[model samples]
Target: MPQEPVFHRYVALGDSFSEGVGDPDPTRPNGLRGWADRVAEELARRDADFGYANLAVRGRLLGPIVDEQLDAAIAMEPDLVTIYAGGNDLMRPRVDLDALAARYDEAIGKLTATGATVLMWTAFDAGWSAVFGKLRGRSAIYNELVREVADRHGATLVDFWRFGEYQDLRMWDWDRLHMSTPGHQNMAIRVLGTLGAPHRIEMDSLGPDLPTDKASRRRADLAWTKDFLVPWVGRRVRGSSSGDGVSAKRPTLAPIS
Candidate 1:
C-alpha cells in the first residue's frame, strides 16, 4: 500500500465557497466555519505542525481573487493548497471565458511550480436551481477549462460539477448560492479522500424532508427571492460586493487548535 501523504501547512484560496459562507458559525472568523476550515481541523489532528490559512472572501471575482490572494498564498509556502474560483465571474451578464481561462491557467502554473500538492474544483452543476440554471452552459465550459488546467499542472481535481448529491435541496443554503453544513462536510470528506489521507469526517444526516406542497414551496421561494436574490441583483447593479469591506477570515497560517 502507498504511504499516506502528510501536509504540514495548508492554504485555501478562492471566493465564498472556500470561505465557508453557507456554513454559519458565530464563533469562527467571519461568522463562518466552512469546508476549508473543517479540512484543516481534521488535518491538524494528524500532524503536530499543521497550520492553515484561508484567504477567500465572499463576492470576489476571479481577477480580484488572484490579485489579492495568489501571491499571499504562495508566500505561505504551504504543502497543500485548494482553490475554487470563477463562479462569481460566470454570474455576470458577459464574461470572456477564454481570457479568464488564461489567467486561471497561469495562476495554477505558478502554484504548481512551487512543488505543492494543489487541489482545484470545477463549478458545481446548478441546473436544478431555477436561479442559477441559466449559467449551466457557461459553467460547463469553465469546468472543462479547469479540467485541462488541472491536468497540465498535475493538481488533484475535485470535480464538483459531477457531485450529484448536491441535487438535493437540503444541500444548499437558503440563498441558493452556497452550500449548507452537510454540503461543506461532504466536501471535506472528498478533499481528504483525494489526498489519500485518513479522516473521521462523515456526512451529516439530512434528517427530514422539506415541505413539497406547491403552496408551501411558493411561499418559500418568494421569501428567498426577497431576502437573498433581490439584494444580490442590487449589488451587481451598484457595482458593489458582499466582500467589499470584508477581510479574509484567516489571513495567516497558524495551528488550528
Candidate 2:
C-alpha cells in the first residue's frame, strides 16, 4: 500500500477567478474566499503543518500574471501550486493566442521543474452565454494548448472546460462574467476531487430562481451592461485594470485554516 501524499505548502496563482471575486467572504483574506482557499482548508486538515498563499488578483491578463506572480510562486517553493489563468485575455478582442500559450508553457515548465505538484485549469466552456458564445472557439483553442502544456510538464490538469454543470445559469454571477458563490463552491468541490483529497464541500442551493421570461431576462441583461459591463469596458479602454493597486491576498506562506 502507498502512503498518502501530504502537501505542506500550497500556493495559488491567477486572476479574479482565483482571487475569489464572486464569492464574498468578509472574514477571509482580501474580503473573499474561493475554491483555492477552500482547497487549502482541506489540505490543512490533512497536514498539520500546511501553509498556503494566493498570488491572484482581479482583472489581470496573462501578461502581468506571468510577469508578476509566477516568479514569486517559484521563489516560495510550495509543495503544491494551482494556476488558473488566461481567461481574462481570452475575453479581450485582439488576443495573441500563440504568445499566451508560449508563456503558459514556460510557466508550467518552470513550476514543474521545482519538483512540486503543479495544477492547472482550463477555462470553462462558455457555450451557455450569448456574450461569450463567439469566443468559445478561441477558448477551446486555449484549453487545448493548456492541455498540451500540462501533458508536457507532467502537471496535474483540472479539466474545467469539459464540466457541463456550468451550463446552468445559476453557476454564474449577475454579470454573467464571473462565477457566483455557489459556482465557486462547485469549483472547490471539483478541484479537491481532482486532487483526490478527502472533502465534504457541497453547494448549498441551486440558486435563487432567476427570470425565465424573455422580457425580464433582457431587462436583466441591460442592467448588467449598465452596472458592470460598461464600467469594465471603460477601464480596459483606458488601459486600467481592476487589480491596479491591489496586491496578492496571501503573499506569504502561513498556516492555512
Candidate 3:
C-alpha cells in the first residue's frame, strides 16, 4: 500500500462562515464550534492526529483579516488552511472588483508563502435584491478573481456560491445569513470532499431544491433585514460607508455590530 499522508496541523482563517456563525452547538460553553471545529472533528474520525486552530472573526472583510490573522496563520505552520470570506465585501454599498481582487491576492500570497495547502471558499449568493442587486455582476467577477488567485497560489477553491444555488435556503438559519446545524454539516461534507477526502456527500443529497417553500422566502427576507439592512443602518449611522474595512483583531465572538 502507498504510504498514508500525515497531516499534523490544520488552521482556519476567514469570516463568519468559517467560524460556524449559526451553529447551535456551542463547543466552548460560551461559544459555537463553527465549521473549522466541525471539520476538525471529522478529520479526527479518520484517525488523523492534528491540531486545529480557527482564527476567523465574524464580519471580517479581506484586508483587515489578512493584516491581523495572516501572521498568526503562518506561525501555525499548518499542513492545511481553509479560508471562507468575502460575503461582507459583497454586501458593501460600493463593490469595487479590483480592490477586492487585490486584497484576495495579498491574502493568498501571504498564506501560501507559509507552504501550507490552502483551501479557499468563495462567497455564497444570498439572493438579497437590496444589496446584491446593486452589486450585480460583481459576484461572478469576484468568484473568477478568487479562482484565478487560487490557481496562481496552487490552492484549492471550493465554490460555495454555486453549491448554495443548488441547495435549499431554508437549511440556513432563520436569518438566512448563516448556516444552521444541518447546513454546517453539509458544508463540512463538501469541504472535506474538496480536500480529497473520500467520504463526501453530494449537494443533492442534502435536501430538495432551493426556494422550496414560502418559509424559505420568509427566511431570506429576514436574513436580508438582519444581516444586511440592520448592519448597513449601523454603518450609515456611523457615516462609515467608505468600505475601508474593519480591524480583524476584534473579538471573534462579537456579533457583527
Candidate 4:
C-alpha cells in the first residue's frame, strides 16, 4: 500500500472561507481561526516540522487571488497547497463561467507544476438560504470546474458538493455564506480524511438547533437581510469589496506555534 502523504510546508489560497470569517477567533492573527488554520494545527501535530501559510482574504475575487497569491505560493515550494477560489466569482450577477474556469485551470496548471500535492474543493451546498439561494446554480458550475481541474492535474479534490453533512442550517452562519464554527471543524475533519493525513480533529455534533420555526425564521431572515445583505449590496454598488484594505492572515510560511 502507498504510504500516507506528509507535507512539510503547506499553503492555503482563496477568500473568506479560507480566512475563517464565520469561525471567529479573537486570539488568532485575523481574529478568526478557520478550517485552514485547524488543518495546519493538525498537520503540525502530526509532524513537528510542518509550516503553514495562508494567503486568503475576505471578499476577494479569483483574479486577484491568482495574480497575487499564486506566485507567492509557488515561490514557497510547499509540499502541499490547497486552492479554494471561484465561489466569490460565482456570486457576481453575471460572469463568464468559461472564462473563469479557464483562469482557474491555468492556475492549477501553474500550481501543479510546482511539484506540490495540490488540493482543490467543490463549493459546499448551503442548504436553503433565502439570501443566497439563487446563487447555488452558479456555485454548482464552479464546483464542476474545480473537479475537472483537480482531475486533470492529479490534485487531491475535496469534493464538498456531494457531502450531505453540509446540507444543514447548523453548517452555515448568519450571513448564509460562510461556514459556522462547527462547519469549519467538520471541514477540517473532511480535509484530513481526503489527504490521508493523520489528525485528531473530530466533530462532536451539530451542537444546538437554530431557530427554525416560521416566526423565528422570519425574524432571522430579516436580520440577515439588514445586517449582511444590505452592506454587501452597498459595497458592490459603490464598486468596493469587503476585503478593501484587509491583508492576508499568514503571508509567509512558518511553524504554527
Candidate 5:
C-alpha cells in the first residue's frame, strides 16, 4: 500500500481569486480569508509542521502575477503550490489567448520542475452572467489552454469552468466577479477533494432561494451595475486597479496560527 502524501510547505499564487477578494475577514491579513487559507488550515491539521504562504494580490493581470510571484514562490521550496491566474487578463478587451497561455505554461513548468505538487484552476465560465456573457468565448479558449497546460505539467486541475455549482447567483459576490464566502467554502472542498486529502471542511451543496420576480431581479441587477460594474469599467478606462496600493497578504511561509 502506498503511504499517504504529506506536504509541509504550501504557497498560493495569482490574482483576486487566490487573494480571497469576496471573502471578507477583518481579523485576517488584507481583510480577507479565502479558500486557499481554508485549505491551508486543513493541511495544517493533518501536519503540525505545515506552513502556508499566499502571495496573491487583487486586480492583477497574468504578466504581473508571473513577473512578481513565480520566482518568489520557487525560492520558498514549497511542497505544494496552487495558482489561479489569467482571469483578469481575459476580462480585458484585447488579450491574445495564445500568448497568455505561453506565459502561464512557462510558469507552471517552472513550478512543477521544483518537484512540488502543483495545482491549477480554470477560469470560471461566465456565460450565465449578463454582465460578463460576452467574454464567454474568450474564457472558453483560456480554459482549454489551461487544461492543456495542466496536462503537460502533470498538475492537479480544479476544473472550475466545468463546475455547474457556480451557475447559481449566490455563488458570486455582489461584483459578480469574485466568489462569496460560501463560494470560497465550496472551492476549498473541491481543492481538498482533488488532492485526495482528508479534510473536515463542510460543503453546502444547496443553492439559496433567490427572488424569482422579474422586477425584483431587475432592480438588483441595476443596483449592482451602478454600484460595482460602473466603477470597474471606470477603473479600466483610467488604467487603474483596485490593487494599486496593495501587497501580498502573506509573503512568507509560516505556520498557520
Candidate 6:
C-alpha cells in the first residue's frame, strides 16, 4: 500500500511578484506560477510534509489584499504565512503612506492572531529614474513603513528590495518590475534561506533543459556584482568629477565593536 504524504500548511498573500509572474510554468489548472509556488515546490521537495496555498493576485494593492486576501489566508490555518505587498499601493496616484501602513499593520495583526509564524518582505526602489520615478519614491516610503510595521508585529522582515537590488536587472522582465524566470528561482532560494528550510535540490536542478553553462553563471554573477557595486562607484566618480571643495577620500566604514 502507498503511504499518505505528510503536509505542513503554509499560506502566502500579496500581489504579482509574490505570484511569480515569470516563473515559466503555469500553475496546474490555469493559474500562473509565481515565486510563492516555486517556494512551495522547494519546501515540498526538502520536506514532503510541506504544503502551501498562495492567495496572491496580479495587480492587487493593499486595500484588496487586506480586505479580501487576508480572510482567505487566515482560513487556511497555516503554520507559516508570507506577506509580500505594497508595490501596487506605491503605483497608485496620490498614495497615502500613513493609511498604507495602517492597512499593513491590520493585516499582519490578523495573520499573527492565527498563531502562524509570519515572514514579510520590503518593497523595491530602483532609484527613481524618468520612468517610474514617482512609483519608486512611493515604494521607498512604503518600504520604510513596512519596516516599522514588521518590527511592531514581531514578524520576520526579509528585505526583498535590498536582495533584489543586489541582483541583475535582467532578473526582471521588460516591464522593469515583474521578475523573470531566473529571478523567481533566485528568489525561492533566498526565501528558503530566510525560512531556515533544509536545502535539497538547487533551483537549477529542477529545470532539466535549462543549461547550467559556465558562461551563463559568470554573466549572472557579473550582473549581480555590477548592480550592487556600480552605483557606489558612480557616486564616487561623480563627486570627484565635480572637483568641489568636498574631500575625495573613500568613505570610511564604522568599526564593528
Best by lDDT: 1
Cα lDDT for residue 100, candidate 2: 94
TM-score per candidate: 0.98, 0.96, 0.77, 0.95, 0.97, 0.71
- Can you list the residue pairs that collide in candidate 1? none
**Ranking of candidates on TM-score, top first:** 1, 5, 2, 4, 3, 6
Q: Write the per-residue lDDT of candidate 3 for residues 1-257, one digit (tens) a residue.
A: 54434456777788777766777654352266555666676665555455777777777777766876887778767778888777777776677887888888888887888788889977666555454455547787788888899999888888887884324654676565678767877788887767656444333244455684789867867877887678767975786642245323223321221
Best by TM-score: 1
Cα deviation at 224, candidate 6, in Å, is: 22
Error of 5 at 120 (Å): 0.7
Q: Candidate 2 on 38-121: residue-level lDDT in tens? A: 888888888888899999999898888889999899899898999988999998889999999999999999999999999999
Error of 2 at 33 (Å): 0.6
Task: Point out the higher-scoring one by TM-score: 1 or 6.
Answer: 1
Q: Which residue segments of model 1 deviate by more than 4 Å? A: none
Residues 1-257 of candidate 5: C-alpha lDDT, one tens digit per residue: 64556789999999989999999999999999999999999889878889899999999999999999999999999999999999889889899999999999999999999999999999888888886889998888888999999999898899998999899888888888899888999999999888878788885554568898999899999999899999999999999999999999999999987
Clash pairs for candidate 6: 7-49, 8-49, 19-34, 20-34, 20-35
| Tens digits of lDDT, candidate 6, 1-257 | 54433237777777777766656554342235666666677666645556567666666767877876788777668777888887766754467899889988988988877878899998765663334555666777788888998888889888877874434555666455677776777777787777776555354432233235899857755764577335534744564311123221101111111
Instruction: Kindly report the root-mean-square deviation of model 3 from the true structure over all alpha carbons.
Output: 5.7
134-213: candidate 1 lDDT, tens digit per residue: 99999999999999999998988999988899999899888888999999999999898888988888788976998999
**Candidates' RMSD to native:** 0.9, 1.3, 5.7, 1.4, 1.4, 15.4
- Which 10 successive residues of model 2 have the least lDDT summed? 1-10
Residue 173 local lDDT, model 2: 81
Collision count for each candidate, in order: 0, 0, 1, 0, 0, 5
lDDT of 3 at 180: 75
lDDT of 3 at 22: 76
lDDT for model 4 comes to 0.87
